[model samples]
Target: MRVLFTVYPNSLAHLYPVVPLAWALQSAGHEVRIAAHHSSAELITKTGLTPVLLGDPDQPPVRLTDDCAPPHHQDIVNRYADVMGLSPEGREHWIVFYQWLMQPTSDYVRLDRSEAEDLIEFARVWKPDLISWDATIPAAAVAAKVCGAAHTRLLIGHDMFGWSLDRLAENESALKAAGLDPNPLATLIRPLAAKYGYEVDDELLVGQWSIETMLEGLRLPTSTKKLPMRHVPYVDPEPFPKWLYERPEATRCECCGRKNRRRVALSLGESTRRFIKGDWDRAPKIIKALGELDDLEIVATLDKAQLADVEEIPPNVKVIDWVNLPHLLPTCSALIHHGGIGTYSSAVAHKVPQLVCDVEGVSLLMRLVEDGDVNKTGTYRLGWEFDEREEGAPDAATAHWELPAKKVESTVVSDFVISTGAGVRLDHRATTVEEIRDLVWSVATNPCYRHAAAALHDDWLAMPSPSDVIPDLEKLVVQHRR
Candidate 1:
């Protein structure tokens, strides 16, 4: 069988999820090729997969300016909400996602028309029996359709695309009553579909089926048929630091003469460093707070850019620029992160309790407020200006979501983590340095968190491994392909 995978350009977040599955297919005697922007050819090859480059390697990848959407974008979203009788909260959700994530992604994917055209042309020539597309790049569905190949969405996190389609259907009546398009997202790709004498529909918008990696409990309700698979992280190889194997030395405790310290891994993740221009504003504060815990040795995977604002590194904390998470996770007692799926999954796999610093609040506007005084659009700025709100402002709700994941994605992960008793979520706005310090200490020393993490790991293991899913995928391809 010929299997082709399509991933969004630039970010490996979209690509890494597919690697283990591609390897599984290749090992099963199937030809697997990953289609991505020419800029991503090297990344694809690093995974030991054949590269199907989508554009000329000579030209620089497209760079979209970071700017607010026009005011009219909000007006249209508001109009849709008003027509649909959505609450202020629901309306704001639309505005926040439409402006920050949805619209920007649509624009980004559509900007490089040549990339999509190239992928479609390759699918035609290669004649792959199946296409597994990154959920973010729905254009791959069109390519699959044009080439008559069975397609499925490959997701590393929550099924936002499928969930959005479900949401659109629920709002169909309200939208039709308002004389608005029920599926604005579908409209975005209709032109591409039309170019090949096809119409944008559910199959083209979602896929024939989806290979879902999120643990079942954390998944949102969606109509798409899903093939559940375990999330096996595939990070770039890095030489292990010798010290990583050595146990952290016991530290003197004020009350107890000396105590063996537990090791905690602090990784805020790559999205903030590469795309957001800065780590979460409260990151330095969290590090310093964690550093104060004498019974915990913190190994922070923070780059110099993220540590630019820090005045001093605590003696208990060793900060490094990068380490493959899977390499460090096994030795750690607890993991503190910004809710990046890679970090979250690694912690789960290693049965390490996690401390996720997700910003809290249902309202996007409320979460972005700086000290409850001014609205700040960027998350990197939320904790930068002030750590606490004016004395009377309601304490920020438990940290729920952060960038990239948005509300739906972050909420699912946090809810699962908390429900499984595996870790705690700290509100970036409301948590003080002391609170963070105590939380990290509790997660590391507490046996209950470890037990819960073990249980969670058991659940993860129960899911089918990538290789285990080969037969099911083969059946799916046979059932769905033209």
Candidate 2:
């Protein structure tokens, strides 16, 4: 079978799963082609798949222009200098803020349309049997419709179906207003029925041929409820190495050349950094905390800009600009992150205990932590509060009062730390010079935390790999193709 995989170009999350799936299909002797932004072409090619550039050719590259200064600095500038005066809730204020923040993303999406048209043209020529797509890329759905192929939506995070329905409906309305059909699922069955000169009910089109049909086609196990809204599925834990369970004491991986077996990993994705900046002095805090640790090796995956910001590097800290985390994580201790779903899932698959630091409500890290799937570490700036004296000044006092350092409700850090097989949740109150030094020493030198983390890792490694249970995801693909 030949497959065309379409994905959103904004982030790495959409690209990761596609790579593994493409590899799986290729190993099974199927031809797989990828359609994405030119920026992601290299990434796709690295996975040994052919990349087809979609959308506009003349679109300019996007740049990050926000002052690398802290949020307080930016807020001050916005309040004193900008006309909006820090009233983010106001329509005009939001318009300017979002336009500034999202300008690059908007430009990228605009370019994506031209690329999508190119993909549609390619599909016309190549005539693939199946199309798989990241749910965010509507263009993929359009191409799938144009090519008369079966389409499956991949969810990178939690199942997007439940709370996403309203957003989907809104998008559908916008597309319809723009004189497009808006429903890719309808394009297939409705067009065929039209060709036979028959009328079809829209409800049946959506219920039978749209969302429900697509889910059924995927061969996903059914939930107790019939409605999509009631049937959001939990992500299954990922599989790890079998040897991890047999030998709980085994920290070093013989297969991969990793040593000094601290099992925890940290993902410093861009969004997480932004959130941290809003709350406190991120750079100094991280440096202070990490500097105190001598026994445990702290591995941080950071971008070049962030790497450059580190003035003094700790001897035990290993900094890599990028890594194949799925390949690297099983060898580590636990995952400490600003909660992104991709990172969360990767940690879960390895059964690595999560110390989540939520920077934004856009990501559901807090929700997951509250549910006991992962341990929550910190609070986010929900929004700015207002004061009567200064109209635009941030309600800094409210933020200070409301935001907890870590999300774990327990009074004892030891209990929270030892019970979950994860590291100590850093208390913002205790994040002063002396407290940071003590906490880092405690986490790094503590044997119990490592033991708990290793035990969890062992449990994760014992699970059956998808290869063992599903054997062939292609069968699911083929069934959906019909």
Candidate 3:
């Protein structure tokens, strides 16, 4: 069977999980291709997949500014408020749900209309037996409907899309009464689906099935069929430094390196470093905080720009412009990152205690002020900014000691870590330098954390591999294309 995969054109992360699956299929002697805006064609080719360009390559990207949708869009905000009642828990969940769902939908709507049109037209020509698309690319469902192909939403993190689905399920009556379509994605993709004579529904926004990369228990319950996939990280294959395969003179890959010492990997995924047009600077302060611990070596994978403001580099801190996360993860005691899917997945895969930082994509976590001085629409500014408006889920977890996996993607991993007694939610805003010092100390010294991390590692190891899913997908195709 021939398979085609699509994603939101500009996202580098969206394609990672999809690539491995495509490789698995191709190795099984199936023809595979990647379809997206031509801008992504070269990236797809670099992955050793056939590139099927859908939209115009030269089209400028669409971005959302604070001004793009203003207070006048009270209908959007009020509608969300209506869906989530007056209860504080409802409001909190709404904040988490709304920011995540709306941000992407904002970008998706602005995608050149021709992007979707071109993809649909290509599907008519290619007639792929199966279409597995990034959940962010709503157009793929429309294409699948037009070409009579089976389709599924492929996920990178905990299914935020599923969270939206649950909100709909919880408030079905209110949503229906308001004449609101429960799925924001459906609302985004419906017009295009209608163009192809496909009636918009939940399935169109989601898919016939979903291929998820999260570990077992963390996956949200959803109406769509779920395929549990072990997130085998596929960084561009690289020759590692000799020290990676061979242990350093003073360090080991086990037990936080040297028997008496601990090494924390201080790193951020690419997006976090460039977050919100590179507005707020947090890396230097983070490095200095981690540096205060004497019993440690900090292996920070950072570029010169991230380190530009740093004058006094700690002797124990080693800074590299870049390094493969898989190589670095196995050698560290704990990881501090900006809650990116790839970093979190790598941390879990290796069973390293993780400290998810609130640098980006954490909206509701802001310190709310009594006088309505919430830090909304700001980019990664540190320090406590939220005040209790009306007590709901009182007492948030500490940022340095534990980071909540609050975002749609991080929640499952965060929950898993906390559930196993392995880690905690990090409140970046309120955490002081001393707190960060203590947090890493606890994560490194605590045997419970190590044991829990190991158990999670085993659970992840037990999941089906990229190659292992081929037979199941083959069966799925047989059923779908019948």
Residue-wise C-alpha lDDT for candidate 2, range 385-440, written one tens digit per residue: 11112224333323321233332212222233345655555443445767655655
Cα error, candidate 3, residue 230 (Å): 1.4
RMSD of 2: 13.2
Predicted candidate 1, C-alpha RMSD: 7.0
Greater lDDT among 1 and 2 belongs to 1
Compose the digit string of candidate 1's lDDT tens values, residues 1-482: 99998887666777887898999999989999998878788888888788888766775344322231222244576677676666664555455445444543463346345777888889888899999987656778888887889999887776656765676688899888888888877877787788888888888877888888888787766889889999998887767888878888866677877766788898876655653334546667887797788777888888876776678898888888888888888889999887778778989999999888777664543222224322222333222212222323332331212333233345446767998899999666778898888888888988999999999999999999999999999998899898
Report, for every candidate in turn, its global Cα lDDT versus the true structure: 0.73, 0.45, 0.66
Q: For every model shown, what is its TM-score relative to the native structure?
A: 0.86, 0.56, 0.81
lDDT per residue (tens digit) for residues 333-402 in model 3: 8887766778777888888988766523443433322232122223322222122122122223211111
**How does model 2 score by TM-score?**
0.56
TM-score of 3: 0.81
- Pairwise lDDT winner, candidates 2 and 3: 3
**Worst lDDT window (10 residues) for model 3?**
394-403
**Runs in model 3 with CA error above 4 Å?**
64-75, 86-97, 106-112, 169-172, 176-183, 246-259, 277-282, 304-311, 358-412
Determine which window of 10 residues in candidate 2 has minimal summed lDDT.
Answer: 361-370
